[model samples]
Target: MTKRVVHYINQFYAGIGGEEKADTKPFKEDGPKGPGLGLNGPLEDAEIVGTVVCGDSYFNENIDTALPEVLEMIKSYEPDLVIAGPAFNAGRYGMAAGAVASEVITELGIPAVTGMYEENPGKEMYSKTAYIVPTGNSAASMRKAIPAISGLVNKILAGEDVTPDKDGYFPRHRQNYQAEERGSLRAVNMLIKKLNGEEFTTEYPMPEFDNVDPAPALKDLKNATIALVTSGGVVPEGNPDHIESSSASKFGAYNIEGVKNFKDGYESAHGGYDTTYADEDADRVLPLDILREKEEAGEIGKVYNTFFTTVGNGTAVASARQYGEEIANQLKEDGVDAVILTST
Candidate 1:
């Protein structure tokens, strides 16, 4: 059976108007045309059964709408694989390709692939989610990226096992079933050989995560009263609360009547990093001194004294949550509203 593959492209590559038509919503075409020929030519066992073209603007602006509609159209064909542009240097186009490929793979569980230049920002964003081949920064590299993806798609359609090295695509930490057996015993022997100054290659490799998500901004600061909390330990001298140094289950609160900030006697017992600086001025980590300054400046309504603490670095999530709840209960009793938690 000929492998049926669906191709996705932007308006510019679809031979439609360029930037002016970048707002085009998705539409289906009968078969390969223009750039689609590149994919069809290399994929001898595969045929471009359908094509989806959308304006870059429409894809980026109305992704929720465009993706579902485009997916609905592609679903009618029931292709074995979905392929999108390895969008070279085009920023918007690269992003569109990544977005569409990720959506199709996630929604349909169909094999998906795309190509992008090494320096292309899209590679950083979506390479792990889909099979993205390395390409040049110009249209000149299309020939290379297209054929690479096509070859991989053909193998996938044939139900053949493909690996990161053999398929020539960026890995997204996805695990595949290994047909050949060589469990732990074999692996240990191979390791022993390597330790004996013999060259050896391990079939399995560790995966990488090149993507990161920035922390979300604090919500509702205008009308909400904010509190201060930290992983820094600024408990009362002589360790009155007896809070555990690292995986603390309890939190402490000190009376800041005449205390401008934590003195030399107050210290952090966290085992993660050097807490020397923070110990000298506990406010450096908790920033109660700054909050007090802000309060004196009328920047905030109130400064909740004696911020919460726990050693974040090796602390179990369950312990952290329990400690948090305890401190939160105290804050509630003291009429504390919101919290500014500083993590190390």
Candidate 2:
């Protein structure tokens, strides 16, 4: 028996405009469109009967309304399965795809699948809600994404076990099957393998997180090169970089070569916390005032010429990680040996 499927894609994938047209609302059409066309041919056990198109911005910004409308459209198709975009690294698109897939699976009790980069905010938001196949950072991986998605769909309809590792998909962070051995036995086996320097996979894998080992302490604070990095969204007056108050897509490096404190004109771009206090005294967030005091007292080395800043309010983990890496690289190049990182 063939499984009926519904395909979802953002504006760009449907021959619609990009950011400018992102306000387009939910719409539907018969048969597959865009990436779905490629996916349709490869799916052996499923047939895409309808395509639901929604703009990325519209879906995300108006999710309260747009999601229901989109879900209604998908429900009209009465699909046995739903396949959303291989949204790649486009944050908004990835989020929309994940949202659609999640709704279909949880709300409608239908199998839903999508593809996106591992770092996609969608994967972070909806990995447990949907079966997501991994893809490259951009649509350049369309060829690869389509096939991977198709494979998952085929296996899903055939009632095959779609493991994340053996098959190529993000872990759903769910385990519903029984294990052959008890938890303690598996743990002991894993420990033994670790002791012998052998490879052993954990029965229950934990979520991914940065396990940064502490760096050796700076032996000489008086001679150390200290730098300030913040996700507190503090910025110079006027926010020249136009860094967002939330979900900041970029970071700014301001020249503080002569700046001793933030007294004259600095403010917080962060939206997660009260901006009044931060705007009134940006040093409260970045703590440059204290650092300056320590420098003047010769308790610590000079503050680096530049300070890194970004708004962490609602920022995706992937974006934050990227910003941190970039900032670290620049500081390393400048021979900055120590950093004081602040966050809201």
Candidate 3:
């Protein structure tokens, strides 16, 4: 039996436009468009019955409204499977693809698959919820991405058991039952190998932590200009930058020139933690008040007028790294000698 499939893609892949058209609304077409063209050849018995196109920004910005609509469209097609982008490393596009694939699986009870770079924020957000095939960081990888994704989709539709290592998808971390000796025996063998200085693989591997060398102590605290940076999601009242409560895509730089304390108008946008205390006095998270007190006491030099903030909850390491680099550059340009970075 021929399996029906629905493909989802953003505006850029639909031949509409690039970032400029990122606000385009959701729409549907008869079949295969953009990368879908490559996907069709490798899809085998799975036929793409329809293609849904949406702008990355529009889908994410209006996810509440967009998801139901997109899901309804896919549902109407009654596809046996749904496939979303090999989104690469484009943050918004990757997010949209992951979201759509997840929703289709959960809400529609249909098997769905998407592809993205390992570091894409969407991979972190939805890898466990959906099958995300690994892809290169840009559309230049489309040729490679399509084949892998299509093959996976075919396997999924056929009810074949898929493993991350063998299938090229991100690990969902689902435990697999295996017939083997007890853990104690395995540990004893590993210890023996370690004592003999022989290479051995452990059944469970510990994650390596990144260690940062501490910077030298400030030589002149009373003269150094200090700056405040936070991942606590503090923003002026309205959250003008629209920074997301989770998986933040950007950071905001706010001027605190003569502000003595963060009050009612300042609140936390972080969704990972309770906002009660942080909202009442954002200084609890950013510590602008303490810094001010230290400045008044001459314990430290002036505080930089501007501070950088973003929600760190579930934020991708890549995005956080980019924000850090950009923030550091701006602080250096503004003559900040040191920074007090706070996080929830």
Q: Name the best candidate (by TM-score).
A: 3
lDDT of candidate 3 over 1-344, digit per residue (tens): 89999999999999999767888999999888888888988887778889999987788768899999999888888899999997887777888899999999898899889999888889988999899999987889988898899999889988899898789898777686874888889899999999999999877766566698998999999999999999999999989888877667799999999998897679998877999999899989999899899999999989999989998865667788899999999988888899999999
CA lDDT, candidate 1, residue 12 = 85
Off by over 4 Å in 3: 17-25, 61-65, 173-175, 194-199, 235-246, 254-285, 330-335
Cα RMSD of all models vs. native, in order, equals 17.0, 4.1, 3.4
Query: Which tens-of-lDDT digit does each residue in 158-192 have in candidate 2?
Result: 99887988887887876677889988998898999
For model 1, how does the per-residue alpha-carbon lDDT over 15-38 read when each residue is reduced to its tens digit? 998766877888999899668887
Worst 10 residues of 3 by lDDT: 201-210
Count residue pairs with overlapping backbones in model 2: 0
What TM-score would each prediction reach against the true structure? 0.52, 0.75, 0.82
For each candidate in the order shown, give its overall lDDT on alpha carbons.
0.73, 0.87, 0.88
Please report how far candidate 3 places residue 285 from its true position, in Å. 4.2
